[model samples]
Target: MTFFTPKKLPKAPLLVVIITLMGAFAPMSIDLYLPAFLQIQEGLATTDSEVKKTLTLFLVGLCIGMMFYGPLSDKYGRRNIILIGATIYSLTSIASTFIANIEGLQALRLIQAIGAGACMVVGRAVIRDVFKGKQVAVMMSVVQVIMMIAPLLAPLVGVMLLYVFDSWRALFWALTFFGSMAFFLTFFFLPETYKKEERPKITIGDTFYNYFLILKDRRSLGAMLGCALPSGITFAYVTGSSYLYQAKYGLTEFEFSILFGLNIVGVIVSALLNIVCLRRFNVLTLIIFGLCWMSISGIVMLLIGGQSLIGFFLSTFLLMCVSGFIGNNIVSQIIELNYDRAGAAMALNSSTQFFVGAIASLLVTHHQELLVPVMGISGILAVIAYAGLYQPWREVRASIEK
Candidate 1:
């Protein structure tokens, strides 16, 4: 039961490594089992649609759970919430392996997402707690690079595990091991970022009210849209990729894994570019740049992605590359504006992202044919939302003078 009480916080590089791994829980959960979609359907004796519901419901739970954990972390402390969440996540993952039916597995996944939500909400709060200004964006990009590793490697690992064990249940075992390690990491290494004196006196009612307050603030709401809407494109791709690659494109499991991994490599490239660009460009500029490119990439995708695999691959790669630039910048803005309410602000930001992702999941699942068009539309709408709502040109001009 050792807890870190370092008078000096861990260095930025080390801290980024720790928090990114913790924050990666949600992505790891989704990506790791992706290659086994067919196996899961067979094992549970369920439809592909039912399996997709597991992903959608998990995202819905993440939305609900983030709203709860964010304010509570503001009231209580980050460390305890993380510990409790990791415990829930680990236990649920273990339970998943033994579930006899798809319904039971879906229930476990929903609960697991709730537990995973704590890590995501609180991890961003920790960054806000420790860093400031462009430093926040820089740190976040570093975090994004580390976090992307989960998806970059997860599918490949899942494919290998499938090859060896020939059972999708082995994937849950790996998750069980990961969740347990996360618990130990939090207990021993993670410091309490939300101190007692700074802790807000939050009530049950205050938690729900906080969401309203955030949405009421136009800048906060706009930055949120800038962050969340692009996520719909991401989820649409994630939800449809397995079906697209394997069923339609006729790629083998290992081949699909490699192609999926390449998209992550695109993200890493953009993230590195984002870190370098932060030295000179304003955060708003980087965000606008990313969104604009994303829209262009999506348009290309809509034009030929449906008919040609190469067109889809190249266009999706470009979209993912630019996407790496958006989240860290937009999140840094949301957090700086709402520093006093970092927990709630991040909760709303993340919850909205996941909610949009849930809707995207449903669309991509039901109408796989429309995946390219949906991606295009989501990208275009994201640009409109940011431009109309946030009005970044004013800030861009301000940054130039500074």
Candidate 2:
């Protein structure tokens, strides 16, 4: 039942466990320190923008690293890239604790993100490599549910840590511990799902050409953007939630964490529901459903307005609930489009998702009120996403169903 044991060999479930752990690193890195943003700002003697830049840099690092890791993993195989990235990730977390300035912290977070990026992109490729048909869909749902646990509870852990240490530095040390755990797990239990014969040759020109080829495909590119745009609003909320709840609403860290956790819990529930739905519905069908609900959630937020905290909580919860359904389904289809070059496909999906998210988060950080702007943009973006996909939904659906 357990994935991690000294002498136990890896199983199918164990691969899920390892990949899920890898996926959690980014969310945990983001969420665990959310409760400490203000404390970090004060301690490091930095402006709000500077403190926010740490998150932006982390996303940027993910973006850049995804591009690199995808091609490199294709060339080098999954296990070695994961191990190397884990080592880099762990070391950076330790180094992050020692940084005295905001700039150093930002730079180190970016490096940390680069390392963490390997697990996420490569993990997805591994899933595609190992599973087929509805099995892939279900396995992704399972991995998504498990991966989301860190975000669901990380803030609670962060709050508990703050209560004990009363310092932001505690988070980085905790990250170091997390990084080490993931590294050990990957090194010990994860087998190489990518075979040597299938590995792509290492060449810069070929990698860039592949990326260009990917972009030239209208359907794939459209789906990728359609999925990523509304998701940007989710990141906007992530970047702004602490400020929105704690500073604006006067909720304590514990209360804010509880509210924050609600969204993640919603995502988990939605993902599990998606697993049941996937047996009957195709990926594109679930995506359309997700987009519709996301738009509706955004509208609810706009009507509910900023003053209604319960309304904000309910609407935000609804908005996040759709993330799992849309992201996993659309991404699964994308992998199917280029299963042979899965690393590149996943890399493009993740890189664009976070890149767009980082920009949205950065914009939200500058605003005075988090609720209205975050919710408003989310609604508009959802509408835009729906519009983008509406034309191709039927075509994509038929293809996926077949």
Candidate 3:
């Protein structure tokens, strides 16, 4: 009997759009509740620090969840695990609306994030299953562009929900709707991309072993760090941007919002440029250029040091654009290198990003003074990661010796 293949799956553009939405669960869940943090604190009689833990808990959950879902998807198939994740996500989001205390809400958010992890892990795996080489980079850029919409619109949506309902619980209701939509989309439209013949015999031991092998490989570690360290810089900005833009730079909320939105737009443009440039250059070259540019941008921002708002903004914008270039290319390389264990590779890659982000967030929250320096240092570390760990020169030398 002829078995199904991704070649017969939905058209590439449509598939890209669908999986991109699946991958957006994290940003949507995080951003949707940000505007309602004060409301949640008041409603639950909690402290600001406790409300902050919810974000930390969510990231923690993402790390734990992706670790399992990656190997699970490799064994079971992408569609099945995504369906399970969507179900948990939707039900937990609904349950969150009924939660009364801060502790209860935190627990529910953690569970909901675990469910979101399935979407993220499997979504990238699906892309790797169907696309090859530079095609992966191009599609990844498209995914980044589309996934950015969640963060761009979520805070506005959160504010609107708060205005309409006058309660922080309304934010959970919105998430419920989003989760439900993801469920229906996955159940109906998403095809099984991980072919049965390709699946490994994954048990608990097998899962850990897969992770061990990936993490132990120098190139994999390097590529994973290449993607993750820059993410730490982005999260640092996310954690500290309000303080930097409003209190330090003396910008109004209106002006800060405009600048924030413009930064995201800059990222989108950069991703689009990556797509165009993929036709002329390989993923590795672009990734190297991106890291170098990010380092320079961060250094420039540090030199500006809030001396000029325009200089700071331009430098920051350039630094953020690296997100569009480095992440997709590095991820594409990781998945390519670990094609036999794409799920495990993505799990390690994505979990490391959350872990790094959590650390960065803490650093910025405590010492807002370190934000620019952290950004500059993260870019420098990313370059070191790519050069020291990835070590493309070894391959060049071997090829010449041959």
lDDT of 1 by residue, 57-117 (tens): 8899899889899988888878888888888999999999999999999999999999999
Global lDDT of model 3 = 0.81
* CA-lDDT, candidates in order: 0.87, 0.81, 0.81
The TM-score values for the models, in the order shown, are 0.96, 0.92, 0.90
Rank all candidate structures by their TM-score, best first, as comma-separated numbers. 1, 2, 3
lDDT of 3 at 86: 85
Q: How good is model 3 by TM-score?
A: 0.90
Candidate 1 clashes between residue pairs 3 or more apart in a chain or in different chains: none
Query: 133 in model 2: Cα distance from truth in Å?
Result: 2.0
The prediction achieving the highest lDDT against the true structure is 1
| Residue pairs whose backbone atoms clash in candidate 2 | none
Cα-lDDT of candidate 1 = 0.87
**Candidate 2 at 17: error in angstroms?**
1.1
Quick one: how many clashes does candidate 1 have?
A: 0
Worst 10 residues of 1 by lDDT: 1-10
